[model samples]
Target chain A: MSAQDLDGGSDAEADGSGEMPKPHTIRLELADEPGQLLAALAPISDNGGNLLSIFHERGNLTPRGHIPVEVDLECPPDRFERIVDALRDAGVNVIRAGAEHFGEEVMVILVGDTVDSDLSDTLHRIESSADATLQDLSLSAREGTDEASSARLRLAVRSGRVDETLAVVRDLAAEKGLHVVEPLAEGSQ
Target chain B: MSLRLAVLGAGAVGGSVLDLAGDYGHDVVAFADSSSSAVDPAGLDPSAVHDRKERDGVVGDADPESVFDADYDVLVEATPTTLGDAEPGFSHVERALADDRHVVLANKGPVAERYADLRALEAESEGTVQFEAAVGGAIPILSTISDLGAPHVTAARGVLNGTANFILSRMAAEGLDYEHVLAEAQDLGVAEADPTFDVDGIDAALKFVILANVLSDGETEYALDDAEVEGIRNVPGTALDLAAEDGRTVRLIGEATADGVRVAPRLIPQGSALSVTGTQNIVQLETKHAGQLNISGRGAGGPETATAVLSDVSRLE
Candidate 1:
């Protein structure tokens, strides 16, 4: 894949094809070095897939401080998922992996003393409660106190689960004194 | 999350887009031709047009407002190249933009004719109108020109169309007339039913307009009309002739100079990356520091065009 840039990666405008028979777009973050693309592609090829096209944007890194790659391949709809598991076994940071239309985007704000209050727990709760990925994040810490910090989290929630995610955000905010900016509504602004 | 896409035009290009979008498994709202653009009051599919219906297919909705009725993050435009014509499909696109949906267009007309208006609405609504497939499908030509960057993109040029190049290459190789070669292309779904844009160089010109608009910073007096577009119809006998005579192949190039840009057929030397770019699409961008960077790939079809659209989705992060 490295020798040919024919491995997985995302380029939005395309006829989604893949090495596997069933088509899915897997977003991965890998160490910026040699053979990373090859390592990712191996799992898909081994499982099921025809090498459609891979856009391993070496220049564009993912949220995990690694290159964000998108792979489009074809595979049996039933067997298409094993490739993702195989990729995980291969020790790649599978940030966001799924059939193209499965992930939903959600934005939430975390409030309260995040630094002192173990912010990792908040993130975990979101994932567990909402079945989503923390696609992007921006945090603001005022002065040196953990009591006054906030984070803007842009999440890729599983599709049709936007309500579930909003419910989780509401619950977490109520539990932790956090404030959430509801998406695109009147007061959400 | 799966994106619910409804392609309003199911031509070769639009059909390819629908096929690609459907492959994503996100609910393909519908795949209908723009001429039959409609919306269902009760959740109609976007890809339904004419008699081409399958099991569980939602027919066209009488109105196109359903595209905005529910919600869609990305709206793909793959209609024909009809710039400046107040077509219903163009109105549908405008409606999508007004509804604040991100758009990935492979359609040539709206971007070429209404770039400034579209740019204004994009800024006002914070929605993105990415036309990567519009200019050169799967070639990343828009990205290449964008790589030219602000204040740095002084000039540019390229072999923009793969379909045209393929026809010309075959004409040169087999010594066939235009009609024969074009008919073969039409049969294979490479050239459209009406191959005026590719033959007359309007397609390249429209794409050049998009490139100039996206890359340029100031209000330059650049217009698609300013382009000196000359097609393969005028070029005498194969690129092979040009290659042998000038040691280069005749390539349909969209060259943008400082304060001006033009789309014309040029002679590219043998062993050049542009020369090596076979089949449907290829792009060569001469940047300020990059100097002669070439990106070649599928320009048309479901997978390649969809790949270009997928790139736009990747950048959403």
Candidate 2:
């Protein structure tokens, strides 16, 4: 969340090499409580998302009777998913997000030493190496990491890079002695 | 949940909606045409009303004005297209929105000519306006843009007018002149008897303006006059032939750009996305991140257009 660590996320990155930040707009439904706007804005700034502007439509109420808020921000595409997650984690209702999500998406399951292998680092490496973005993830360690823990990952990769992205994950999983359940592989029955 | 419905303009589109609403668990509480209308609190029989209108030339005892006051959850406006001021269609939408009723518009007038006004009305009203049938009859183009969100659609363009496309396609394939093909289209009911609106590119331009406004997310509210329109009326068969020699075909393409809306006949390579023939309509959206999205289907028909209207109704909360 540090400004100095802008390129730290697995979704989008701005390496301070002068890449123009991508502009995104998110439509939200917020309770008309005091500090709701601030509570919403905190996660955006926390995730290295540059604030562009916010239009809190005080007069208009969505179907849920909550005030409609439109927030415009600029960030690298790689970091957008993280910013979205941070907003949701902060309990902000996101009705709409950035339009330019990755075109192709795939789901894979990894079983074996998930916690010990450092899932966050593995996700970051896959996104950075394969030019893929992590979307939704589910981790389960019911039997504890000593036996086998499984994690389900939903990834949004650039079109035509699904095979390569899966390969990157497979290579990393091989080195870590983790078993990968491939869903996007051509030979998968 | 059964939806109480009020339908305006019981023409091809409206009548079709009346016919199919029951299948979707929606009841046409009130139905209106230009001359006579029917308003019922419970539910109106679609067959009885349609038969009365066609057989006896009268729909019901109530006048069109009474339809406005009818109790209903949603107002389906299927009126004919009237450019310029957009007339009764615009006023119908305004009244429905003001009365806190959701509106599903198959008419192009309110959305195309009066987009900004409609947006203001929608912002103030509890009810929302959906017009999937306005642009592409059953192609789901407008809603697709909404689903994709506004900022991502960098540019959108396509062949919007089926009548124009039909005429041009026939002229290209059969080696017939524009006049001959247009006459054939009229006989086949593919083009209107007057055919001025479609051939002169005004119809396509209106739909293009609507698409532009929707894609921009109201960043740009393009008026009918703002578009630079050149219809396919003057297109000759020889031109299509010449284009065909180079593996190209002439099509009436309506495009929305950052500058403004434009409608004209352009030569595209055969088998390309925009090279659709006959009454087929194609919409292609150039997105910022999701690459390009292309949707094509029948652009206009009684059942096809009504299907779009019914889809909008089902989408209503």
Candidate 3:
């Protein structure tokens, strides 16, 4: 993970004057090489983009055995497309690139008969109803599926949508007689 | 100034108040359990009262109703918390206020459940009401809010219940189940024999409801029924394990704003101010001018809570 410099410089002439530099997130898949992250980040800075943060998921891997990296940068509307094209042009596999997508991650634990309640269906409902993406899940039912079980879910939600997502989760859990332990809002701690 | 005090309820808080009132330069003129009372115009001996209560199960030979007849300046209400109507505690406070006497409460029921009625009674009389012990014990939460001005304080939140926090912290620390940790807490006397009030989030909810009532400043009244509460009973060890993996831990946190109160097991970053382990408690106040203020201390205990009650007594003119 790279340090997030929220003050991403005042150099905003990449896409001409009178246009504000909007934040954009780009996801890339890299091989397990020494310079893979450095190589992947080069195209972002080379395309006149100001780097904001680099979330390097070293412990996590793509299905094809590649490291996943999420880079947040500030660029004008037209320049964001150019940065994505330049990354692919430089042979960096750009998996996802967008401005109005996942901006924050929230984790919650749901405890109940998750297995018998059709956990997959519950996940689908959460994703659709909450406008969130199922990022990861870890279910523990050591007492067997017949008994109470707990599942920890990591959901990728758009920024400022955490409260809405949690309300949806609480409603769904209530319907199934499940309990949801939500993460406290950022900075409230 | 030395003032005469009539303490209600002979529980831990009331007993400690009787024992320590002399040290604080006050006199317990009257003391009562539910059944009996002890009154001396000057001051009763604390040890003698304790011995009589221990041996005969009565604080004194006087009738419980006779406590009101004693010449006391402050009424210390430390009865067990009751919900809904808040019981005889409310009636005791009402009687004290009607006599133009100050009331210092260690009981949460009257404050949390019947805030409007209590304040109305206070408004009708010349006396004032201060209930610092009703919130975070010995943490001076209410006094700090008073110093900062309740309007300047935006919100209040923390691990208010020590018993629930003890169970959660022990579960996270030893990777034990909730029942196992709760049993250990019971054996250690950190939790009561019937842990429903503590573990089910009622105790914490009541405290936060009191905070909410205070923060509202008589604009909006809050009660235990208004709080959205969730206990720590359903939180498994695996959930804590997962939170620990991400540099976080689960705490039975409660929040109170002018809007309302909420108590639940939420994930907070490990080592944060709110992540107090064992039977420790912490309170975070969101203020308008001061950014954020964190006050941590023993939230509940005989001596610890007596300090709050005594401090409230001293604040009264």
Candidate 4:
């Protein structure tokens, strides 16, 4: 893809109009052979998909002795289907293909009785209400669940939704009597 | 350009002003410490007043109210800060302005809690209020805003509280709990015996509230109640550990914009400009054309704050 296409993707997203490019992840199983990886990737760029990343599982093999690969690419909503169809038409085993458009990562620490407040339910509510996905979470309950503990949450949110997502987290934390140490806003540093 | 001064309050800041006024070519004509006053038309000796205050808990035999009647060109309100009506501090400024005399304030109460009232009094009198010492002790935050013309400055944010910063930085560096670091800070004299105003973010919030008032330039008025303040009291050591693991550290940062003011414990990058260590303070001003200007130094202390108060007195001259 041309450099203009990549810039065009972000520009379209910035203006919040037209058919913006959406990031999608594809899981594929390729045979352990020379050019198998290159052959699988050719269909994506050929169908106007901008390659974001390629997670080549060289040592990871499927039950059938095939290498499992995960590819992240960005393209318009309509072109995404064509890219996936082209991959399948090339005789590549498409394990899964779906859109996951998280463009920003926000880190926050919630301090309180995180466990006693039903953390799973809190996480579920954040995901559904804030339109964010819980990417990673590290809980430190050294003082036991009975005492106050801190949980570091790394959330993946849509671009420009950091403030809205944080507001939701703040509301949730307030309800649970937890304190949230939010990161400085983007570009503030 | 020497000026006659009347200093109110005999606390650290007030006493420092009285001690350093002569060095700045100004004479202390009147000095008070709530209960007593020392007044002389020809100016009073700084050391004599200090000695009297040290020996007998009082500055002089004169009544505190008599300070207003002294023949001074500027009144320095260095009293302890109070919330709401801002009490005697607010009254002191009013009396100074009513006398058509300039007033320099090192008190946050009158400015943070009664900005509009102070401005109205300034408008009705020949005197003008300059409170560079009220916000960041020695950082010159308000003066910088004044120099840039408040309209050109959009926002101000920084580590405004030394006590809170000392406690947080100590906790982060030593991996100690909040209580432990706070006790250590008290021992080091970085934090006061009752640090609720600092640790609970009230002190920082008051500074940011003053900043918001300056940035608004009378278009808006911000008081302490208008700020959304959150303290570092709830920030456990594990929270700092978690932030450190991710290449970040926590600080009690206060932000003031035309929109509003908010002071809270925020996670900033470890080596960023806002991550000031110990009792140091930093103020970042976002100007309309100047990008961002950072002014950092000791945000609190007797002599450091007195310098700010003296600078205000010089401006009055």
Candidate 5:
């Protein structure tokens, strides 16, 4: 998983790095089909991730016409990073990942030419580099064109790691010439 | 292979159902009661299914919790009746249905009261709500006659309440009056402390409502207050004497008529199926295309009703 490439996939095979249990969560979308769920599970299970529980809503349809699945799994500390990397390589959307110890709750918004700029790349950068979790997302492509559409991402990030998350979002928006709309911090609020 | 099992409400019917469903190699989930006496034994093993006092899969610690919110594919509603008190017992069933869980209910009072609401909910969730034990005790009435559009049953009636019919049957056979027969039934625990629903036509009337709603493909609304009810309160010499001329016996017939459903005595044919339905027994179902379909068997005992429910549960897959 490169810190630069945005399409998330880094490899295609199980170079098993394994995982240790941590309290991290990720949200993802996949095409609805028989093997999609199994493919998603592979990244966690093959990497030595301990499955706590899985909430598979087969009936609830996601935006991509797929079922929404929430999996809570445990991974070992030693192989956690490699497990995440393997997940990215397998083309499993590593929407969010962290070694159970990192990440806390945070809310942020960026203003810019979101549609014109590659917003998907920006989100991937934050996850791969900033140690934050995208908890929930609300997007408005109201301007309709890909160049001007904007999206709001609600994230669960490592506690005290909000600055790192914001830094990535800020830098990406600046590079794409998009505006940033962020929340108030310590004294500002 | 083996599976998990649980029995909620360890009363007469629940006890019986647990015994039967457990017979097949399923590990008992736990025996549960409203008060739940078996909460201390952690992880009640599957072997407990055979314990005469033990029930598998109830709401206690030693038992598997009936977590209505969690993902369990099946539920069986076997509870005693509370004619109008629509809480925990029957309402627990409502929760099960809401979660889209499969259900087989032996309890009739709740269906009599909440069938329409539950049916709509099931339809919305795309789940199944079956009640084979509601009306005809051990009789397979619900499955036998489910053509709610009336192509199957243009008109139908039943000798529904077996307990009441049993009491009436004894009076006709022994040539006794109401007091002696009532005393005999009470000693046998056939009637309840408040005998209004069973005798005053409320019980049979509610069954009447269930039949009418299912047969008409309508809703569950018992304008029961409007129904003309005539319970056997006293024995009259002329009534007993009427038997001499009619050559026919008396029985409680819950009839769904053209104008409205009614429960009363009608002179049935001498060798009619319903007339031969005997003590604590039932025979009543008629289909238009299929003609008359008579189902007769023990209609009121707990074990029989339990077997009725478990039979449906086993056949679900």
Candidate 6:
């Protein structure tokens, strides 16, 4: 696949295909070489990743004396993981790889019958729903699966999609008979 | 770099590949059908050979034997599926692999009937074998599980045969008998006139064998006979009706585990993953890390099967 500089603004909004291209930033520690930056960018472009920008820190160096470069690219959700995989396969050292603007994260608590009702499937449904991705998950079932228990989930949603993502989670929780403890808005004094 | 290809069997599957290979950056340098064959070091005109076959039942002036010496990087085997010894197809693959040329198979015969022998051939040969189209026409079933890594994939189950699944689904939804549905499926070109391989579960069993072997990671060798096969021929409409009463649908599911492989009609709960209708085929992989990944799509079609073959060609190193 060839990469095109995805025309115009944020590709995060759904294209006519009904699938959004998420913009992601990848931080990499590259050895100081003539074509190291070029080598790293090849994989991103080859695996259907659209080049957005490159923040090549030629003036600075990391502790190990390697230049740290951050690449900004956009690709469909399905293609993002593959670009990362291809980059790694090409021997690029990735420091951080994720969405650049999942600007909001919410921690929701679920209580009652998490395990017996299939918690894994519920989480799977939320992620596959495409509005958000699960950032972290923690479950506390001290008593037992049969008894009431609570699970914590940190969901990373697009900047403007926090409410929509939460609504999906709430609906899924309601169907499973789980109580939702919504995370309060930031800085409530 | 564009790879040169020599396609054997020149039927629908092979013809589609011959017709569509150029769009995917593959050049068909040579091709062979039953009666005649053609070869060119640069590239063959796909339309020219197709027209020849349509008019004269042959592809070219050259004999079929010339395919062995054709100048190509990958040899595509798209012959008919044969059981037991897996004749001409096996010989075709053996010849290609022995020459250290990569092979892509849409034919189920060599892989199903003689997996052990084929594996042995692949072990010594410099070339590799890819058969994604053999199991599911357009769905990347084998490549998906294989790319997920064999260790991660624990089990695989799916609705593999479109014909059998179509027959069974229509019987349930229409409340029709097996014979009536089978006839309807045949009329719709979903089932072949000689539908024994599909209805008797041999086709599904062959796919399960391929899946089992792929999941085994070369540790286990599974032949067509290794699977305990049961077709949907005896599946009565009454059984489907009884299943429907309980909010279930009967589907012919092919399952492969580390222990064994089998194909039989099983009742799945409504809205379940395997409850696909018509000619859709689905394969669900049970993985250790990731959850079940279900891939469903057209199981068999000329262009679809050719696309799988071309995808394999593209992945050939």
The TM-score leader among the candidates is: 4
lDDT of 5 at B231: 57
- In model 4, what is the error at residue B249, expressed in angstroms? 0.6
- The digit string of per-residue lDDT tens for model 5 on A1-189 reads 322232212211233343323444445556677788778878777877777766564444543455555566665555555666776688766444433344466555443343324545566556667776555554443232222333456667767888778778778766777644443232110
- Quote the B-chain TM-score, candidate 2: 0.98
Query: What's the lDDT of the predicted structure labeled candidate 2?
Result: 0.79
- Candidate 2 residue B66 Cα shift, in angstroms, is 0.9
Predicted candidate 5: what Cα RMSD to the true structure?
Answer: 31.0
Q: Write the per-residue lDDT of candidate 4 for residues A5-75, one digit (tens) a residue.
A: 12322333455644667777776778999999999999999999999988675554555668767788888
Candidate 3 chain A minimal-lDDT segment of 10 residues: A1-10
After aligning candidate 3 to the native by TM-score, how far in Å is the CA of B260 from where it should be?
Answer: 1.6
DockQ of 6: 0.01
After superposing candidate 1 on the true structure, give the runs of residues whose Cα lies further than 4 Å from its correct spot.
A1-189, B22-25, B35-51, B54-62, B144-148, B238-246
**Candidate 6 segments whose C-alpha is farther than 4 A from its true place:** A1-189
Order candidates by TM-score, high to low: 4, 3, 2, 6, 1, 5
- Worst 10-residue stretch by lDDT in candidate 1 chain A? A1-10
lDDT of 2 by residue, A1-189 (tens): 011122233334433424456777666778998999999999999998899888675644655778767788898776677888898899988865763446797766565654334675576467557857666566655331133565666787878888899889989887877756444121011
- Quote each prediction's TM-score: 0.55, 0.63, 0.81, 0.82, 0.54, 0.62
Go through the candidates in order and give each one's C-alpha lDDT. Answer: 0.61, 0.79, 0.86, 0.86, 0.58, 0.79
DockQ of each: 0.01, 0.01, 0.35, 0.41, 0.00, 0.01
Tens-place lDDT per residue, model 6, A114-178, is 43346656765675564565665555543322334556667777788877887788788778876
**lDDT per residue as tens, model 5, B1-317:** 44343456667787676666656544334456665534212324433533534444433444334445333455667766656543455666667667666677776666666656666767776447667777777877766666434446654466777667766777667756556666777778887666767776677777676666667666335545435554544322223334323344456667654445766543343345666434555545556555566667777777888777766676565
lDDT of 3 by residue, A1-189 (tens): 222221112223333444577877666778999987887888888888899988675555665677767677887765776787788788988765666457789999888865334665576568557857666777676553233577788998988898899999999989888888899884454
